[model samples]
Target: MERRVGEQYRITSKEIDQYDDQGYLVLKNVLTEKELKSIDPIFDHFVAGNESEKMGKDFCDMSQPYGTPIEDFQLVNAMLPGKYIPSFSKNIFYRIAKNIADQLYSNGKAAMDYEQFLAKKPTKAEAEFSMHQDLGYWPKTKNTWTATFSLALSDADVINGCLYLIPGSNKETELRSHRPKEYGTATNEAVNRDDSHTLIIESKPNDKIIHLPVKRGDVTIHDERIVHGSGGNLSPDWRKTYIIAFRDERTIAEERAIGFTHSHNDEVDWNSIIK
Candidate 1:
């Protein structure tokens, strides 16, 4: 059964154990129909190429470099929707995510680290997000409690590009090397060049990649260090997703001290930029 707007979804110890072992968990029917209705229009507004004055960042192609033409783009994303749409933070989905995150934390406390909105346009074969760990994009920090909650706004399947993850990859103590997709053989210093936002790691031939397909309202939670990515949307329907991440407050401060900012930190006047 789906949870109501104000109702919370209880997280079981078994689920926590599973998350600890596999580094990911899928909670089905976490959001009710009413809650979906409230947020659908907000996502649609961005997906349709509309911009709001309050939005901190504009949607950009994740598959290509920063200034790639819109028509040539495949997967597009907007970060920190809660910054522009206040209701997004107040939604039941966010509350349930927090509840689950609190349970996963050793100290029983968690704070909002960041959030994002992503969409895979229909039939975009090159829209796939390559395999990489979330910590690969973050600044080096001691915190390891961070987790990301991905809420699907539309049905996701193999045909429409669902999430794929390597089981137990989070067990690795060290982060693998990652580089910008554009710089095929360039040094890690190429990441500082800032030409491309997409960073990827090479997948091993023996890695066990599992595809997770879910209906709208299902939420998938994954550890920050998990090796994960999604395929391109080949079906006619769009695959839209909302992501909220949480971590210990101390880690958040450490990341800030290192001058690390999310890709969505760029605030722009939408009306002026979008005609």
Candidate 2:
């Protein structure tokens, strides 16, 4: 069940208005060391299938393997489960979501969902995420609002390939404006922004920054339109993070009908992941 807005938490009018206009917001240190450590076992259990590689830093691969006929645990979100529930009975995820909901919507209903990526930054293979917004992958014809929350499992900095953002660039529409499918090819928006003047998010462990150095346990509340992505990890350490998507319950049905589907544990789950 989703948490109630006012009942669980509250967001100031100022914060809500800022997110509405800017398309993204960064909340620092939303998680404590104790809170983050509680999730370590779940993450380690999931990544146990993959062999960690050593270069300059200790990291694990979470992305799809290059040219392989074998099953890559890195590409499968289903392999890692339960750690993403956001809020367990004593966990803070639900509380975090409640606060976000209260700020984003006065009505205050936050729906928690799956966790994606138990990613690790590798040394030899620098981690690189294409510049793009979560909204780009969804059906563009539909007029609606959705948001994704990314919780960092490790400290991210410029050397660690922290997230880069073009302030207010979320206002630009890739799906709305007519352009070649490759419009954002160079500036994928998922990895890097196309506009000038980029902002690099520098963060500390348990100290979260939205759309920037995705800090461990720092919940990033972003409008689907936010133009953001991170460069490859240059540091000698791996950066691990979890991503969750949520939206208003009113749009739940529509999101399910048109959103992408995922196959899990030999069964196909449709539209359930979107809401």
Candidate 3:
């Protein structure tokens, strides 16, 4: 299953149907050992160095208020690494991801919308991301077709903060009410502080939640409207994930016009906030 450069990862019709019905799908062994190894130094250089603080944000729980102490922050997220490390965008994983996305998209084409690194630190019980849909963080557009490909850089399991999503949640025509997780009032228009990046939708007690655990190099793809989140890394090991998202080029431009930007945008002065 070690695909070479330029080799496409074909998506079967059955896989596409499943994604349509369930809002998420997992593809195993999409990256070879060599490809995975090639990313090691990049992750190390950022995670183990002071530069990470300058380029990324550290937070505890998405539900917590902003300004949590740095040492108490259980998750470290660096967005758009390709901006600083050109090799990231040049990786074979991105090409294969685009290939797969092309097959899943109705238009038969996709563009690289954004990418990021999310690392759950070991033994951080409060590191969980609150339940939320990707669209919750974006502006409403006529064509909401987009896919996020999350590649596991470390073995992901329940103990180590694997993704959990609600089945068929993507079918909702209207966006659910979402507010910054720390907001005290129940208002759909609750604006998040400039420093806070998380918005959450409250899940009902009867929702069917599915947790997806994958081995290193496996990738999980999900729709933009899906209600999803991950748990804390209670294990003694890190749960590292590299996420790349694809969308129609037109949709990208439409969303940008409405002042919508990803939380980990390179344009932000993250160093001022994180430090």
Candidate 4:
């Protein structure tokens, strides 16, 4: 989709420093009231559409139900509604996300890497987001500035497993080896199980961890290498988040990019295991 972002989204020097140093930044009320209102019903509609049983992998990817039996990870229930959900990709959110990506990407031009709605169904607090860096999974994404903007559609707090990230994790630019295990319809998330959900850094420097209890209109943007994950939802309502990720346009082509699979039985196209 060729989108013209007439108005550029500019961040302050402080925000840039935060993102550069900490590998993550949280911005509140990114969408105005009108935009929020526009997005609300559209997001609701997408969530409702996830209830259909006929969603395919390329379209609305409504995965296994919350109670699917799994030994490796919880049956993670999620949906990537971007390809089929017209309202979201056509609305202001898509444009705004791209604009932000365009501004942050080293090439100053970006393409949509992916979009997904991660949900933690009520009472299943083990949301099963095994912690890992995004770039580790996407080895072919090439070295460029890629970022993920996770916009909060619902209140993502401790109750609903809000995002948590470690500061300055991006200082180490090397992409650590990630185990390419399919977490059972959870995601094609490359995982470093030992580093999941915790950050232990012994440094001659200060260390910080941030837990975002973001409101409806807030967003958390993080670099592809930052260690990130969230807990499960203990709340009564479904905890849903809208994730829009972008990589440099040149990095996402079929040849440059590798396919990620979400099923345990599915095999990755390239070599991912250590002999």
Candidate 5:
């Protein structure tokens, strides 16, 4: 959780106020093209290994873990020591997590194991993700113990499945949606009725939006109840991102049920980022 120079990003008071009020924040240019360029190809190599000839498949099949092959395949589980560690992924976990811990929470450290580098591509039968909080999948809690850092690897647009969020929705009481009954589960979708509550974060390449589109290294520290979701990818290219989900010590057990653990003493492998 200690800060590192060249990796530390200071959150301003104004930005903090805005994030507290709006439920999200965007940090632009956190990752330069040089950084992204180095990592993208490595990730592409992983995706290529599991390339499925079945182009229209709903999700990555047994061939791919997340519709993209694994770059540092060994890093999938943090408990094991692995040889696959991409520089970008490693720097983000150590530097970004440390910066956030230094700037936001005192006496509390950010555990960055429950994170994933995600790649979402359009399929023949792609479905829109339902509006829900990031914490929707976890057990209920009264305290704020978790947040997410979503870094978009490509230009995310409505035409190609941009991420949509209910701004300030994080401030409201938590609401639960029924679990997807099964694969291709039916979702009771509804319109966003409150303008003040919802705000869509449509992003351009290298233009980061917190909780969604962050520069290669730009991280978003959000409240657990932030209302967030994404539209299906409409673009021909895939939407790639590295997500580092951070949590407090008390919440570690609950997170482990979902399969995330640290790599060392108070340290999570940078490659352990998951969905």
Candidate 6:
């Protein structure tokens, strides 16, 4: 059975309102070093597969931003590892994370929908994600309001490419047009934004961008519609993040679906993309 809100986690009403207003909230040291260590064995298993270039349904490899068939696309993103490694689902980290999601999502009533893990290799410092909403990639879901939790298994600082959010970006309930793949294509917003000032550039308007440099056990929750992405890992430490996504189970958004299902996992080559 799933957990309910206000049962195990203690979050102030004010904090919930803060998340509503700013589109994100950060909880400090939600797990201890020992708690994080309990998850290491599972992560190691995925890492081993990734290091060996083993790509599969669960072990997903990040494609080169250019969407080529060349030798560059090798960074790995392991999905639903808990399903493959049962110990991962039963770990203390999962329990604490689930409890937190149960408390903060859907006015403290949402349930767990999906979870994934991302390991940013130190050498893949150039493999950064474009600023876009998670909703753009997901299928027609019954819930539109999703609470995404990102827990850092290792220390994530600006040097190691920590996550960042565009404050209040989720206020618009409409889904923006996204490119076909995680390749370096810009969203419709990027293409249509006012061109007078070079609207979208690397870390542009640095003042408005919120960089999340969290430590081990730190968790950051953000509205799924918020424009969030991370920099490339320039540091030697591996940036490992465990992500849990929660949904209201009823908030649906299919009216604006533009009918594109191509995502990062699609095996389309660069030449096939309609430029």
For all candidates in order, the CA lDDT equals: 0.78, 0.49, 0.76, 0.59, 0.48, 0.62
Highest lDDT scorer: 1
Find the candidate with the highest TM-score and give its number.
1
Question: Which of the predicted structures, 2 or 5, would earn the higher lDDT when compared with the native?
Answer: 2
- The whole-model C-alpha lDDT of candidate 3 against the native structure comes to 0.76
Better of 1 and 3 by TM-score: 1
Residue-wise C-alpha lDDT for candidate 4, range 65-85, written one tens digit per residue: 222333222223334564555
Candidate 1's residue-wise lDDT over 1-275, tens digit each? 43334566777788889899989999888887788898888888876666634442356777776666656768978777776667667566677788778877777368888888899999998889888998777666676678899999999988989999998999987777776577343464544325666778999888899999989999999998899998888899899998889989888887666555464443322222211
Q: Write the per-residue lDDT of candidate 3 for residues 1-275, one digit (tens) a residue.
A: 33333558877789999998888999988888888898877875665544545554432234355556655557766677786667567577787888888888887357887887778889988788888888777666778788999999999999988999988989977777776556454664645445467877898888899999999999999998899999988999999988899989888887567544564432443222221
For every candidate structure, what is the RMSD over all alpha carbons to the true structure, in angstroms? 6.0, 9.8, 5.3, 6.9, 10.4, 7.4
Provide TM-scores for the models. Answer: 0.87, 0.64, 0.85, 0.72, 0.63, 0.73
Assess the local accuracy of residue 125 in candidate 4 as a C-alpha lDDT between 0 and 100.
Answer: 56
Q: lDDT per residue, candidate 5, 1-275, as tens digits?
A: 22235666666777767666776667666666776676576556444543223222221321122323434221121211111333434554445555654565554666654544445545412434445565554444334556566666676656555566766766766354433212321563432211011222333254323335433445455556666666665566676655666667666765465453422222223223311
Decide which is better by lDDT, 1 or 4. Answer: 1
Instruction: Superpose all Cα atoms of candidate 4 onto the true structure and report the RMSD in Å to 1 decimal.
Output: 6.9
Q: Can you write out model 6's per-residue Cα lDDT over 1-275, one digit (the tens) per residue?
A: 22223324466778788888888988877777777787776776776564333334345444343223324433446666655556557456566766766666655356555677777777677756556677655555555677788889888888878898888878866655555442235564432111110112233454377798888888899887787787787887688888877676443223224332222233433322222
Residue 41, model 1: lDDT of: 87
Give candidate 4 regions above 4 Å deviation.
1-9, 49-54, 57-79, 180-208, 254-267, 270-275
Sort the predicted structures by TM-score, highest score first: 1, 3, 6, 4, 2, 5
- Which scores better on TM-score, 5 or 6? 6
Q: Of 1 and 2, which scores higher on lDDT?
A: 1
Per-residue alpha-carbon lDDT of model 2 for 128-195, expressed as tens digits? 55455555444332445666666777887666666665556567654322111222335465331212
**Poorly placed runs, candidate 5 (over 4 Å):** 1-5, 49-89, 122-127, 181-221, 257-275
Global fold similarity of model 2 (TM-score): 0.64
